[model samples]
Target: MPHIFTNRLGGVSSGAYESMNLGVNRGDDPACVRENYRRLAALLGMERGRFALASQKHTDIILRADFRHAKNDVFDPADFVADGLVTRERGLALVVFAADCVPVLLDGGEAVAAVHAGWRGTALGIAAKALRELGCAPGSVRAYIGPSIGACCFETGPEVPRAMLGLMGAEAEPFIVRSGEKYRVDLKGLNRRQLELAGVPAGSIEVSPDCTFCLHDKYWSHRYAGDARGSQCGAIVML
Candidate 1:
């Protein structure tokens, strides 16, 4: 996968979404976001006009975006209400943004996809939808699980684990740990399991070692930063 998983280290945003805030609809200065996107495009060796993005809704809805949507002047929420995007068009970059959610990238056989899988989307099988949209057999797809809230700091009530257990069963059990009345959830690990269950090979999955919640300075952690946070992004290219 020709992908770039970026932290909030390099950009020109200020205040809350400081430096590399990739979110355009988050009330930040559009010029700043544009500059950040420009920097990102330069790093990826792609034209900023070719970098397509979606307004991730934490749903299983998968949409295909190209340079057209990438250059749309409007930032309406409906313009890109997709959790996952798949494309076979080379030079068009697919981007997925997240603060605490898992940003998954999968590419194989001239097709690639970027997915935003929060807990709700995970329960709803967004990753599986991405695989299907990419038009690749699950076994042939290589997945990259990007930085997200990790087990180290993802303390949640039993309801979280219950939803996961109900959605994934014992296959996801090992990633959930019991801690008194709370559960320490390994969302990335469980999402990897979700990919596996969807037929993606376990050996083909690569996970980022950094955890958003634990590495808050390096990432934007909604759980740790509340409403005032930036975003990290997962960008993939199809070759």
Candidate 2:
């Protein structure tokens, strides 16, 4: 499995999307977004047309992708709306975009998956669902939880914690802490726990310590830059 979590560096987009902006519908120049994909394809030794991007909408939907889903350019409209993509086809790269949301990559030996886990998606158990979609023994799967908003900066009202608690019960308590009038939720930790609970070994899951909101200069952060920001992606291909 070949995988990468892109950052805000190394592209041609300018202004708020300066440099590597992989998101196509984020108000970024379409030409610049295409060039960013080109650069990424070159770096990964993959064909630009072999990439299958998820039309993420913070849902738990997972799609099994193949060459038919590949797009020749970033401007092409996605045929499906899913927050996660799983594929056993070699050379058909699966990609999921994220700013302050968690991007998870799974390598299940014969298959691979790319998942975008926003708070809503996490509550819907998108990570575990993606793992189940892999159709492999969980212990045999290796996962990477990419950079997102950390607990230190993810201040939210009661709704977020309530949603997590309803899904994870007592298991979600440790990751959600009181923050004066609000709460700080650890989305990465929750996603990791979901993977582990689904049978993936804790040691097999590598969690990135980088917080998108904290390292906004290196990665895109929706909370930090709002709607004007670009999005990075987590891409995987079984080759």
Candidate 3:
């Protein structure tokens, strides 16, 4: 799989989204965001302006990448809230922004995906959907689970873990840690399980040891700085 993760460490965005913010339509200056994309492109060793982006909406919507839709230029900044992005073409970079949510990158022989999975998306099995759209059986797919809110920091009420349990039943146990009145949710673990459910081998999955909530200097944590903070991103490309 295409290895990728971008924090607040690189870029030109100022104020909340700070520098290197790849979120195009988040009200940051268009030129600054473009420059940030340029930096990310350099980091990924590709053309500075040729990255395929997605419009995320916290749902399980995933689009297939082929000849026509697989343009190598990133210019569509109208509505970026699609939750997941998948592609089977080389040189077309794919990305998804996540502050408190998770960035799951899946890849194999021909297809790749970068997905934004919040509690809602995880409950809806967005990763599984992306795997299906990638047209690769789960066994061959390699998944890189990028940094986000970890279990120690992601304390949620019953609703979040409930949805996970509702969908995954007993499979959600190992990922959810109960803590008296609250629950410590392991999004990475849950997503790993989802990828496993979709057929990705457990050994092929790699979860980031970084936790955004504890490492503000290394990442953008919405829970750390509230709405004034910038965002982080996960990007992948076919090679």
Error of 2 at 137 (Å): 0.9
For model 2, the local distance difference test gives: 0.93
The candidate, 1 or 2, that scores higher on lDDT is: 2
Off by over 4 Å in 3: 66-75, 79-81
lDDT of 3 by residue, 39-126 (tens): 8877777764356666778888887654455433455643434678887778777878888799999887788888999999999999
Best by TM-score: 2
Which of candidates 1 and 3 reaches a greater TM-score?
Answer: 1
Model 2, 98-194: lDDT tens digits are 9999999999999999999999999999999999999999999999999999999999999999999999999999999998899999999999999
Best by lDDT: 2
The stretch of ten residues in a row with the least summed lDDT in candidate 3 is 71-80
- What is candidate 1's lDDT per residue for 115-216, written digit by digit as tens? 999888887878888888888788898999999999999898888888888887887789889999888988898888888888988899999989898889
lDDT of each: 0.84, 0.93, 0.82
Evaluated against the true structure, the overall lDDT of model 3 is 0.82
Rank list by TM-score: 2, 1, 3
What residue pairs clash in candidate 2, if any at all? Answer: none
Model 2: runs farther than 4 Å from truth? 47-49
TM-score for each model? 0.93, 0.97, 0.92
* Ten residues in sequence with the least summed lDDT for candidate 1: 71-80
Residue 237, candidate 1: Cα error in Å is 1.9
